[model samples]
Target: MSTVKKTVEVDVPVHTAYNQWTQFESFPKFMDGVEEVTQLDDRHNHWTTKIGGVQREFDTEIVDQLPDERITWRTVSGDTKQRGSVRFERVDDTHTRVELVMDVETSGPVEKVGDLIGSIDRRVKGDMERFKKYIEEHGTESGAWRGRIKPGDTSGPAL
Candidate 1:
């Protein structure tokens, strides 16, 4: 597995940042290589991505979530094996620090080479930068779901 971590400070309140993040369907707007994200429910999502002409589809479920604080998820089904979390921190009333940490498994030599060459890290960093620009320009979240889900619990109501 390869671990990548990145952070970006956006000119938006913590809640604003967190709320936008919860709207997983909007990720492709700013997240590079992400073709689409379908929020299957409040805690599950299906993702489509293409990088270097290779496309992948995956399903992931949120493992833990705390409104305006953090959201964590792990892959449930797919060839892409990974887990990650995004954290929101208040820098002030109008600024937020967003941190992302992910651990991914490489199933083939192409992916393994990309990981070793720091391509994954650079890609994530670019994603964070794009997110910062996106929120700063939009000035508000498109939508939000403030529901909470405890780790390992899947009985929560859908969005």
Candidate 2:
């Protein structure tokens, strides 16, 4: 597995950023390579993406979530193997820092070579940067799912 971490500072409040992040279905609008994301349930989602000329589909289960804090997930079945988390930190009333970390495994030799060359890191960073631009330019969330995932509950995080 390979890990990548990226962080961005957004000109929005923690709550606003956190709320916007919860709206997973809106990802395709700004997230590069994410063809679609469907919120199957509060804790499950279907994702369609194209990376490095390869199209892949996956169902992800939320492993942990805490409002205005963090969201973690793992792919249950898919063309790729990965686990990751997005964390939100309040820098001030109108500033937030978003950090994302992922552990990924490529499916084949070609994909592995691409990954080793830093394609995945660059792509993830680009996605986060685009997300920052999307939210800041809009000045509000496209939609929100204001739910909380408490510690020790283990039923996946709330969105």
lDDT values, one for every candidate: 0.92, 0.88
**C-alpha TM-score for every candidate:** 0.96, 0.93
lDDT of 1 by residue, 70-150 (tens): 999999999999999999999999999999999999777778888889889999999999999999999999999999888
For residues 42-90, what per-residue lDDT tens digits would candidate 2 score against the true structure? 8889999986678999999887788889998889997789999999999
Q: lDDT at 57 for candidate 1? A: 97
Best by lDDT: 1
Stretches of model 2 off by over 4 angstroms after superposition: 150-159
Worst 10 residues of 1 by lDDT: 150-159
* Candidate 2 lDDT score at position 30: 81
lDDT of candidate 2 at residue 108, scale 0 to 100: 86
For candidate 2, which ten residues in a row score worst on lDDT? 150-159
